[model samples]
Target: MMENKPDEPVDHLSQLPVLRLNLHELAREQRTEQGQLALRDLTRLLSALVAGHAAVQTGQVDWRVRGYTHAQPGGDVQPMIELKVSAVLPLLCQRCLQPALQRVQDKVLFRLVEQEPGLTQEELEAEDEALCVRVAVDIQAMVEDQMLLALPLVPMHEVCPQPIVVAGLEAQPIDLPARASPFAALASLKKGK
Candidate 1:
């Protein structure tokens, strides 16, 4: 692999050969890896990360990946991939309906498996931290997925960008005649009778 010059920008992570690296071998090699990619490169992946009022495609996200092969007490080898991501995204506050900055940082682990194991409902529900994927994994896609998972379900400011005022509450009361009692009509009828 040609090393990038310090002055030149790093190549997109998607173009890296690391995607095809055998997990076990990579873990053993302890590869020296470094790359920077724009958040906009993950257009489709970040499509749902923004609120209706904020545009988030223009931002920077840092990514680092490491592989590890762990030997269990029983001598079983566990091939795992670790990914770290840090990003600051612009999001709209749900309460104030204004643009706000959102910070997202996370580390995720992927356990490499030849094929997906069929787990019972209980097991599936119990498993949350480590995900298993096939050997020939798409690293870029995985990175995008991890970033999406880290996004806040609802992004909002601790103190709203602006005060929220209810339109109905703020509006002036309408002038109208007082409502007449139902008994008034009955008394009128009795008088006529």
Candidate 2:
């Protein structure tokens, strides 16, 4: 039998689950300036997200997010988080098999869902049809996902201007005829005879 102890408090915050912020709420909670969140506060929130393993890596991202909320035709509230990201990311070059710097400038649009319970399967399915937000907007995650998606699968030079030669393998020489075929000599002999 498992005994519940009051002293051993469970981390309810962890269990509280991730909530998607209503876009409208996010818009309303904007920082003093327009189109930007406080860098310090945003960094703190980003750190939490990074710690939770929700984002890929900290040092690689540089971007901003502009969020807004609006009511849909059916009266469902939705948050739209728009991200503008630009960064120089290191990726493996397919041709050279070496690490290369890739400049990325891209945008991503994500929809936020409300956190609610007691909805039936049909209702949940309907909500899913709508933009569902599994986790609150973490700027880092948004930027990282967008940048990763924008990057090319194989990075290489378009024209491959440089000449490449593999160390171990050398070019094979083409074979050519050393002398004329016997048929040609026979034809000349027949003409003379």
> TM-score, each model?
0.65, 0.46
Q: Which segments of model 2 are wrong by more than 4 Å? A: 1-24, 28-60, 74-77, 115-131, 134-136, 159-162, 167-169, 172-193
Residue-level error in angstroms, candidate 1, position 31: 3.5
How well does model 2 score by local distance difference test?
A: 0.53
Encode model 1's per-residue lDDT on 28-116: one tens digit a residue: 66553435556766766456555442335457777787877767799988776677887787766788877778888888666666666
Write one digit per residue (lDDT tens) for candidate 2, span 1-193: 9766988966443443332344445554642111222222333333322233312243345666566665789996565666677655545567875545567677655555465545688765642323455544544444445665677767765444456678877599668779988999999999998
How many residue pairs clash per model?
0, 3
Q: List candidate 1 segments past 4 Å from native.
A: 1-22, 49-58, 121-136, 171-193
TM-score of 2: 0.46
132 Cα displacement, candidate 1 (Å): 5.4
Lowest summed lDDT over 10 consecutive residues: which window, candidate 2? 31-40
lDDT of every predicted structure (CA atoms) = 0.68, 0.53
